[model samples]
Target: MQSRPSPVPFPAASAFPKALSWVLVACLGAGLGIVALRPGQAIPAEDTPMEAVAVVPATVTALGALEPEGETLGIAVPSSAQGSRVEQLKVAQGDSVEAGQVLAVLDSYEVRRAAAVRAEQDLRVAEAQLAQVEAGAKNGAIIAQQAEIQRLNADQQARIASQEALVNRLVAEENNAAVELGRYSKLYDEGAISALERDSRQLTLEAAQQNRQQAAAELVRLQSTESPQLLAAQATLAQIAEVRPVDVALAQATVDRAQAGLQQALVDLNQTVVRSPRSGVVLDILAQAGERVDAGGNLLELGQLTQMAVRTEVYESDLQRVAVGQPVQVSSAALPQVLQGQVVRLGWKVQPQSIITTDPSATIDARVVEVQVALDEPSSAIAQRFTNLQVTVEIDTQ
Candidate 1:
């Protein structure tokens, strides 16, 4: 009874509040340290270690695709005397064709056209020969030669005048190109256009200047050769006695030979079927069945799809970072996995990005050089399914 009365005098102070007080103080200190420490470092009391990776080298990625080694071959139909229509498109796009297989056909009008051209040329030659004979009979060989020389001189003068006009036009074009190039340069600096566009404008200017120079050279050539040639011909003819029957006979022989050539041309015109030059898949049909195209107009394009190469465009600014033989990884949407390749070639020229992404504001004129990647065998098998297929290429520049 006495012990119990003594124990009731003191209420046991709860150690919980004191422990909580110490805990709060410790938390405050720790929080302060954490807030005041290096930005991303772990807590001082933490047991887990931080992990990191060492990154080195770099890579460049570009969009491009598989092009044939020799590029696509273009087939065309010759323009005839009369315009020819495409009678048939025998092979459609993506058709596999053999060498000499007909890809398209032109109407028979081309045959008639070839004959007409030959005839016109023969008629002109005959008329000249007759005039030579008549002039010789009435006057002399010297007079005939003089007349011919005058005619040649007139023709040369007309050519010179025409070339001079061309030169003038080319110069004006060159000047305009220069102005445009300067304008493009300014805009590029201001970010109004892509670097590719600026470079393309520069190319146009250079081509214009080159054309002007060529025209000027042609004009000089005609002028330099015309008078001397005519004078020499006149001097030579003055020494001849006459335009004889033998000369007329020789001229007739020449006409006969030309007529033979005309026959051959006519035969070719009948066989106006456009054929593939090699065994390959047709990539494009540039001409329609009913369209009429002149000689050298593109009818269709063909290429061997078995051997494939990825063509990527690298930007001019980043071109310095790329080199031949760099390891590349090629990927296409058609394939389930990435394919390996090597940088077989680096482009000497830069051009615009040809395969644009879905971005509407993509720079179509971005000047980039075409880099070709020879694909690995396994990758090529997949690429063979698609010709001119777009792919992304990553070049490791390590």
Candidate 2:
């Protein structure tokens, strides 16, 4: 029976086998071509209509670092202080500090403190002197000066009175001698007195006149000297009784000089103790006890870790999409959870990227703009401990 069927015309079976083989080959070739072309075309969503699919908002992604609200601060010694050594450290790493709180004491502390103390004493002394001058002479001194003036006036009056009395007595004697001389001359003329007696009377009258003249001249000289003495004593009393403007000014100037000295001393003394410029936590100590610090050299690293932020270096091409108040997403390997923030600032300059990746294929020469994102309170609290940690930032630019 098989021999009989084969012998019969079996063209349909042979044709079917050949056609099936060709069709199978074509199907395989078409599938290979479709797979080859698939890489160049976007894959269509399965079981979803293109019109109903939602459009994703555009975003700018960049590498960034976690920082404090203001950023990490390098606390250093005053510029004016050079080659200063740390004597004592009042804080340790991770210590919370307030603004203006003393962080360390320098070796110059004791010397500067002593200088300040001396300056303060000098200021007090100068102030006292100024007060004394402004108040004029003491009450007791004024009283004593007034009493001396009065005493001088009384002495002058007594001397003048004594001189006047002597002059008056000498004038009386001269008058009597003149009368006696007249009488003796008349007697001599009348030949009633001897020549020797008349001569002796004349001599006595001349002597009396000379004595009166001498006494009058002495009284005038005494009055001139005594008047000036009394006037000088009165001037001395007046000078001590009232405050003089020139004297007060001189005393006040001394006080001002002392005050300035004290202020300078205080400033120098304050420089001996390094204080926190802001409220923050100490991230690290750059200079330890017994270590020397140069001008502008760091003493410690500090940050306001209570409020955290992310500093993103957005590509210049994507910077146009970034703006203040835009929502941002920050992620880091060190962080347990994603952090949320909003763009608060955008850089005005475009510079070379600072955040370098370990990946050799990463674009290292790309220019970027700094974008500052302020984290929410909860995010900040969580990210504070990871300051300066590298992170990935995504900014939604819908």
Candidate 3:
């Protein structure tokens, strides 16, 4: 039945249309294979064609780990109140120290010498005053007065003995004249003597009595006029006693003045010894031994390493985010470990613009604020880890 159908042939133009359809199908398969093997070709997720949308790429620049910039100032040694010379240095750079430790000493010779001289003068003056107070009077004056009193007493005794001898002689003469007068009277009564002899005997007895009365008056005068040497000596003794107490008081006052001077000198000498005011680590040494320094001169630099702090500079735009008691994270290029800190203070005024500048044209005239942060844990290990290290700090605004 099919051979019979072949007898009826088709038109050539119709065959051309069938060949064209096959060729078109093969070309479509080849185009699909080429598209599947192409690299970086993406297919849309959706079945429908999507409209084109315009997009802008964001401009991003990376900073150094994006940490806050910290600015620290280097300081030199501070001044000391004590004006002592550098006799000895107990610590050096990078050496640790304690509170109230002796740092150096000064020359104390001048002060000690002054004190000793004052003490010696005080002792000599005090001893001299004491001796003067103890001595009542001059020995020579006392001896002269005693000798005069003794001479006057001896003269009075000699006068009394001579008067007694004269009285005895006068009495014996009177008795002899009385006996002769009696014999003359008896002879006159017996008519063996004349009247003139009896009269002469009576006159002789009266003369003897007058002489005895004069001798007695002379003796009474001598007894009445007494020597004044004892009274003079008593007055001198009273005067000496009165002045002795005053002399003693004056001596005591001199001694007190000398003692006060000595004490002041000693105090000045003690001030020459220099010592540390507080405990800390030595940062630098400014002066050396035998160097003449002035008053309040710089000696050494010291700081408490156990208590560390971080200082950061915040830009004017970021100043609002910084405040007291805010948390911060600190990192240093020299140290691998990170540290935690808290903000302790915020600057009241903005800092000068020239401090944080790279180039003159790149510098912004806006002033930056300063912030101080206190570390949580400060130790020797932490100090060694961050010694002379440039640090970075990050603060949270929220």
Model 1 lDDT per residue over 244-268, tens place: 7777787777767767776776666
Model 3, runs deviating above 4 Å: 1-85, 94-100, 107-256, 294-296, 353-366, 378-381, 384-390
Q: Using TM-score as the measure, which candidate wins?
A: 2
Quote each prediction's TM-score: 0.48, 0.76, 0.51
Count of steric clashes across candidates, in order: 6, 0, 0
* Candidate 3 lDDT score at position 334: 62
Shift in Å, residue 296, candidate 3: 6.0
Full-model lDDT for every candidate: 0.80, 0.90, 0.64
Q: In candidate 1, residue 378 scores what lDDT? A: 79
Sum up the clashes in candidate 2.
0
The collision pairs in model 3 are none
Candidate numbers, best TM-score first, in rank order: 2, 3, 1
> Per-residue lDDT for 291 in model 2?
97
